[model samples]
Target: MSSEAKPLSGLRVLIPRGGPWGDLVSRALRERGAHTVTAPLVDFAHTSEEDQLVDALKRLEAGEFDWMTATSSTVADVLTHHNAVIPQETNVAVVGEATAVAFRDAGYHITRTPERENSTHALLEEWSEIDTGDVLKVLTLRSDVAIPVLTEGLIDRGHDVTQVLAFRTVGVPASVHIREDIESGRINALLVASAKIAEEVAAQFPQLPENTIVACVGVNTLEVAAALGLPDDADDPAHADYELKRALIESVESVIDQSDMLD
Candidate 1:
């Protein structure tokens, strides 16, 4: 493995993801000697906004959707935990094995799940075997920050889609403790999980040092950073941040060089 792409040894990384997904990223970074902290930038709850998705759920029960894709377990949690029953014949697709497990535990059999490249485009391609007409509504039970790609693609393919807001994702203003870490340089890089997280963070701190390296999970995330006037590269992704770190192991100097560019 390239040295630079290895675990962020001797570096401090901050993750702004919400829910158990954030915990996964934190654990990966810690395995590489990087001290990790998750100051949840967003929070999730199914009850705060049910009306918007209730119709979608009602539709789901009626077998209105052919394939249901849950972006995160939180979405699955919202579906199965509080009286949400996914419709019959609704072949389930999950973004990752973790989410697939959640769907399985919820008593739903998952038909498709991706091991690598966890993104909407990935999910779209994974299920490409199904003809356009076979898929009706691709219900993506996700947060407000969820992008439009998968749903749009399904539409482009002549399939209807319903992206329900199963939960609200809002930033928690940086706490005094977090600000102290940033200002003190205790945090070396701001690893972003989504474009929304990057956009919101940059908006909150416009004068934030351009020096902060944004190690991200995918292209859309990078776009969000660039849109907010922050530097970004193609490798940034929300779902596979650890894969990037592993890739860096073989190219430490290259990563540090990228870090230098951010600084």
Candidate 2:
């Protein structure tokens, strides 16, 4: 749709996810004339929690592990950001090609690349017999946003796991602002990422403006937004900033299209 046809012009949107992902999504929404609001819910920082990672590397250098699963490129960045290097002998498993390329850039040799969606569930489908292999420990390098889902699943299969908090989601001051904005009974749309942020919004706002459409990145996030009483009025999206922003516009258009006032 043309920028002038943007129905969300002068509309307000609440964003609660933190980090570059949030920033990118917000920018896209603003480009469509929506007044994007930020309530930085997740905070990311470079952490030195890779101490054991270094030790793991030491073992790898001494020839220890059979394979390591890199969740994403960020996982490699987390390791190298702390100046840690991988053991040349440790085989690499990655969820995506981007992550595999990252491992290659980091001087690692990838033995397995997950073809399924870049999710642990997809990875597990391919390696269901993970514990049966000589795979020592499946080192899952991840941000705090990673719940115990993967860890719990992997361990259930009898595989040894190492937990490292490569990064964490920090709640910022945006929750308070979003509450005030939404409860003020003015605004047109709400954009969200994780269920955690949506939960905080509900707890703080208690009430949101009627006719305010809620848009989110994934189906799971929408499920959480539903639990927070957002209902089924939002547009479906895959969490990418540009794609979600477009979905948000289309949703608003769909709403307006059915309204007599717009006609």
Q: Model 2: clashing residue pairs? A: 39-174, 43-170
TM-score of every candidate: 0.74, 0.60
lDDT of 2 by residue, 188-242 (tens): 5676556666676666555666555566545556677777776443344543243
Which candidate number has the best TM-score?
Answer: 1
Top lDDT hit? 1
Quality of model 2 by C-alpha lDDT: 0.57
Q: Tell me the lDDT of candidate 1.
A: 0.62
- Candidate 1 regions with alpha-carbon error over 4 angstroms: 1-6, 45-49, 62-64, 101-108, 132-137, 206-212, 231-263
Error of 2 at 182 (Å): 5.2
For 38-103, candidate 1 gives per-residue lDDT tens digits of 887766655455786888888888887778877566777787656677766778776654465567
lDDT at residue 226 of model 1 (Cα atoms)? 74
The regions of model 2 sitting more than 4 angstroms off are 1-15, 18-20, 23-39, 45-63, 70-77, 96-113, 127-132, 143-145, 175-187, 216-263
